[model samples]
Target: MPIIRLMLVFLVFKSVLSGVYGNNSNSENDSKVLQMLIDCGGSVTSLRNELQDMKDKLERLRSEAATDTYIRWGRSSCPSGATTVYDGFAAGSYYTHSGAAANHICLSKKPKFNYHYSNPYKSSYIYGAEYQTYESIWNNLHNHDVPCAVCHIPRSSVIMIPGTDDCPENFKEEYRGYLMSGHHSHTAATEFVCVDGHPVTAPYSSKTDKDGTMFYFVRAKCGSLKCLPYEEGKQITCAVCSYSP
Candidate 1:
C-alpha cells in the first residue's frame, strides 16, 4: 500500500510539470503572434505614407500643368474687299531684323503706275487698281525684290507712321488712299511691316467712315509684326478691313 501511494505521487508531479510546459509554449506562441501583428501594422502605415507622397506629387504636377501660360492666336484672314498682299511665318515670342524669325512682303502685287498723259508736257500716275491674291502678290515680291521687302522696308515708315506716307518710296502712295477704279473704294488695311523685340497681342482699331466704309487697323507691338489669314498652306501678312456701302 505504501509503494502504491509513492507511485501515485510521482505520476501527479509528472502531470503538473507537463501542464506548466504546455502553458509556457502557448505564451511564447502568443507573444510571437502579437509581434507579427505589430510588424504588419507598421508596414501598412509606411505604405500609406508613401502613397500619400506620390499623390501629393501628382497633384502638384497637375496644378502646374493647369497654370501653364501660352497664348496661341489662330490663323487670321485678310480684311474684307481686299486680298492678301504679303505672307510670312515667324517663330518664338520675339523677332529681329536678322535672326531666327523671318519677314516677307509682296511688293509686285502693289499698284502699278498706269501712266495717263493728256499732253506730252504733263504726266499722271494710277496705282493699285487691280485685284490680286495675296499669294500671287507675295510670289511677285519674292521674285522681283532682293533680300525681301519685309526686312528691307524702312523701319521709320513701318513703326512711326504706319499706313502713312513714310512707307517705302515705291509703295508709299499706294499704301493708303482711294482706288482709281472705284471712287468710293479705299485701301487702309494694316500691313505687317516690321517685328517687335517681344511677344504681344497686336493692338487694333475699328472705325466706320461717313461713306460707310469699315476700317480695321491691327498695329504691331513687342518687336513682332501682325499676321493676316490667307488660303490654306499659305501665310499672309495683312490685316482685315471691311467696307459696306
Candidate 2:
C-alpha cells in the first residue's frame, strides 16, 4: 500500500511536469527528468526492502523474549514440551549451619572450574539434598537423593504458587507438586520450593539419612491462614505455571 501511494504521488508530479514542459522542452531537461524518475523508483525499492527487514527483526525479537526459565526441583527432567537447560543434583547448605545461603541450588553434574581454592579453615559448604517426606504422600521418596533440572519454557513468564496444585486461569501448568522446605525445628531456616509430584532420584544414590540438606513437606496452620480454604495440619501443594503475553 505504501509503495502504491508513492507511485500515485510520483505519477501526479510527472503529469504536472509534462504539462509545464509541453513539446518546447530541451533534450537536457528531458534527460534530467528521466534521471529524476529513475532516482524516485530506486528510493521506493530501497524503502520497501528496509521495511521488510524491520518486520523480520521484530519477529525475531518477539521469539527471543517469549522464553522463561526455572528450576524443576526433585526431578531430573522437565515436563513434556519444555526444554532442559541442564540436569543436576539438588544441593543446599547444612541444615544446622546458620552462616550460609538459605536457598537451594541445582549443581551441574559436569562442572568446569577455572581454579580450585583449597581452604584449610572451616568454610561454608553445600551438600546433596535428600527427601525427608516419611509417612506422607512422598514416603516413597524418603531418604533418596534429590535430583534437579533447569527447564526453559517457550512462554513470557513463569510463577510458583505455593497454596494450590492447579494453575490460575489463562496460565499453563508446567508441573504440580508438594510445597517443601527445611524442618521447622532446624536452626537454619530455608525458603520453600516446589518439588515435582513424581520425582526422580539421583542414579546410584543410596537410601540413607546422610542429612546434608533435607526436604520436608510444608503443612498449613489455619488459625491466621483461615480454615474454610485451608485445613490445619494438612500438607500444602504447589504448582508451576507458565504464561504467554
Provide backbone clash counts, one per model. 15, 0
Clashes of 1: 15
What are the candidates' C-alpha RMSDs?
24.6, 6.3
Q: Which ten residues in a row have the lowest lDDT in candidate 1?
A: 67-76
Per-residue lDDT for 1-245 in model 1, tens only?
24475456545644565577754545555555445555666787799999999999997775444321111111122222223434222112111112212212232323356568434674422111111112432222211111111222211122223333333432222123211111112333222332221112211211211121111123233223433322332321322121111
Error of 1 at 216 (Å): 15
Against the unseen true structure, what C-alpha lDDT does each candidate score? 0.29, 0.86
61-137 per-residue lDDT for model 2 (tens digits): 98677898999998888999899999999999989988868999999999876556655466778898999978987
Which is the leading candidate under TM-score? Answer: 2
